[model samples]
Target: MTSYFNDVAVWQPHDLAYFKRLKAYGSRGVVVKSSQGGYGGTPYINSVGKLQVINAKRAGLKVALYHYGTFNSLRYGQADPASEAKLMANTAKAWGLGKDTLMVLDAEDSSLRTKASADAALFFNELKRQGFHSFDIYGPGSWFWAGRLKIGTSYKLGGWPASYGSSSSGVSGAKAWQYTDNWKGLGVDGSLDYGGQYTTKSAEPEQKPEPKLTKQNVDDYYYTYNPKRVIVKRTIYQHKNNQLGSQANRGRKLKPGTAIDIASVHFSSDKVPVPYFKLANGTYITANRWFVNNAYYELSNLKTIKVIKPTYLYRDLHRTKVVKRSGFKSNKWPKGTLFDVKKVIHWQGGFVLKLTNGFYCTAYKKYVKKIK
Candidate 1:
């Protein structure tokens, strides 16, 4: 099971450190895809080239060069067929990579479904015909051979990281797998790369013992004690702290549908910088960013509530109100009486809930209802 790290044009500044660490973790090979510069010249191969040089300087390192068939159509038109071949040829020559280095064609854009497939097939076949033994193919699981083009044995697979558990089963004759499109440990500015036999290990264990918490639990609290719980769903991205706004704190993005066990919740007068939860395995991570009501629920019960209302703030002190209503509200409750939470707003010491109907109210801890 050979693993290939395939991020060429999307390389972030900190990818160098990530590559080094990946190698330390037992990766056998690294492949970089080249991207065009901000000013738009031949995609700058300098960073990737330098990394290759550095890896070559080290012992027992394998590095490959890859180029995307086409960048975002919005930014760069479908990669010119002639230009694509030239990019591969030039990068190989510049990096002094011989037949030992792998050359990959990552083709996953829906816009170039047919054209890109043909181009990639031609490019890789040409490389193989010229005696390039390590040539490969890559793309998101969905887009690979979308046009039904026959992928010759000369090419291998470079799948997106998120597609691992789901689509990896369908991949055949793939010499390498590009498991993740992003790695947050590299920071928002950096991306983690994985390849070689090291990537075959499961990065993290699945969350177990699902929580039975439901909308009834939330509504029971509102009616019995007037407090409500908010539920937020977070997806993991490759860059852990990439979307975080404040420099003072860091967080992790959850895999699109990965379940997490929420340990605890906290509220503050100021915005809470989401904390990054390190996984037992150094590879995967979790972040506690979503805040509901005033309490933070652990990943255990958190997964039960899919729809959460935002926290709303109210200035009027006289009227006692119930802010945001959860979607899991009791189906037995009257329609107008149930208020949905839309957004979360900070107030006093903790946070306030914004009801779906546009009302604001405060939830006291005593009002929390826990229903099995």
Candidate 2:
């Protein structure tokens, strides 16, 4: 069977935004540092580290913890694996980590002289005895090297090897691969979990429900800067540009009342005889239909204002388009009609307003008073 890896983003205190910004990316799981050794008995979890673990759970990602272990008499001549394991277990227990959660002991210390693999077994044995059910061993490429830390398969321990820019972890039955330390501009080790110790079972942020388009007009968000501003009216069967001339696939099908974004307008070919809107993703949505330019929507906040006097409210400030919903080509609002203004500005030789409900008309600033 061919082995595959599942993505799981990891972060350390130094390389760090922590895990709070995880929603911005699609990492399915995260492994955070629980604590570290070499500082004596009572290991302290940095506030940032604690927050990363907690936030990973809130973001619906499977969370795990790892600890950087120390050298022992068998490895480098100093640092006890037994002492380190006990401290690691005690720290996690106090932090309230469930025994079911995967814990990892980083066994990649390079200064070991001999018997490193035996020391690793001792560490794992201690963790298992301390009640960590799904713990694993994490080491660099050197641990599996001939004379360095020779990991034993008899222990039946799962491995997460730090193999940077390489195609393989070089360790048999490895659970995950620490593929790289720097990915997507983050200064942290990244891994691909192989489902031995961790699984990508959670709701990812990218799979959102598509909006329904039921009428000739509907309002939905389009990306301007943050997918929250710059509303535009989109119509059905609008062609996406890059898909336009491709033999492999035709342009994307756009349904009537479907809301789409315009990255920018393009008229690449005059011979084509139409304009197209560049989508936020660099693709294109066509403006082949004339009515597309007239989709009803608002680009700003809606504000209520008091109409001081009865005035003719044209659908357009220039009286070009009338609000047919009012049953009048040109409607009139009596004194004291409360209207929400989407846009208040100066028009041709007069003041005009765009209504929140998608009516464009002109009204004098003095004749209409802003409520707040």
Candidate 3:
């Protein structure tokens, strides 16, 4: 009788209840795909990896993570393996994986076969340098048999090779042998654990101490939240505090150019001069100067503006040239003439409103009455 553990990638079904059922069916542990090749110069993190890890733990299964290696591909091979390893390690740490978690490198790509050992050595070495110790390399048994990926003698890392049809994995010194693609009709890859990483439990990483809170300095701000409306200018995460670190939650992606209503601003002593915005929904987002624009927030809030007093339209913010023939019957907008506000620009000591016709006018309450 062969004891088997399950391993999954994006292709596998990830229902939490299903994992509970796998545990009930006598499976002891599982390996989950955590990342892939670098995307846009960073590791391509699996969207469901965190969810899978959580569910597996809830199901009482001893769990670990693996990265689908592509550093050997023609497109990504030019990159240093250390960079990819660091990105992967950082991502895993961000996901709350423990330092002792078994991190496996799935180096099955034929393009990697020739240099698998050297590159895997470098990749695992960087992971080790980053405080991750337990590691393994998984691939076809023939790759090891042909001397394509000899495990480094200096490192405690082991191999996990797949050799389906046989009772034993042909590769010598393999930590585990993947024996079947479908175990007990579960429709997932099954590996026979050899009493190593797959069976050993990993401890969670230590949590950092929370930082002290303080009122945001006025000098640290460029644009103040006037109407409680904010617009995201760059993708950012929601954090529990103003201090930025791995604790920033990546589950919710505050995308660029998104206009959102904020409840208020939170001040913190994060060493960096940025304040945090408390959203209407009670989530905290960084008010990083480079990541948000309050100008758009003001613009989107003003649906229309009414002329409370006579005003002349200027071609630009300079307010120097007011044409004699304005679009209306006169050069000035008459009192009570209503128009939609298209843009808002902060000018000297005040804000300016732009009309749909590319004309600018003072946004002062005396000149224009804002209509929500």
> Top lDDT: which candidate number?
3
- RMSD to the true structure for each prediction, in A, is 18.9, 20.1, 22.3
Clashing residue pairs in candidate 2 are 71-79, 72-79, 263-278
Q: How far does residue 309 in candidate 2 sit from its true spot (Å)?
A: 76
lDDT of 1 at 292: 19
Candidate 2 — worst ten consecutive residues by lDDT sum? 221-230
Tell me the lDDT of model 2 at 206: 27
Steric clash count of candidate 2: 3
Question: Per-prediction count of colliding residue pairs?
Answer: 39, 3, 0
lDDT of 1 by residue, 1-372 (tens): 344332433334333565566556545445555432212344545554556445533624455566656533233543344455566666676666665556666565554545455565656665565566565555654454353333443464333322444535244443344444443343221212333422232223333343343444423222122122323233433223333335334344443334443332222222422233323333223233332132432212211111233333343433244333369554222322334455444444344444555544544322322231
lDDT by residue (1-372, candidate 2, tens digit) is 222222232334422344445434545667766666534445545446555666667766676777776656653343466667777677667766676667777776554435567777677677778887666677776666553454335555567777876788877666677877665556655677775345443211223353443232222322211121122333333343445545454455553345554556555443422344566766665443322432222223437777776565566567776554356544566668788887865454234677787776545443566674
Evaluate model 2: give its lDDT. 0.56
Instruction: Point out the higher-scoring one by lDDT: 1 or 3.
Output: 3
Q: Judge candidate 3 at residue 258 and give its lDDT.
A: 70
Candidate with the greatest TM-score versus the true structure: 3
lDDT of 3 at 263: 75
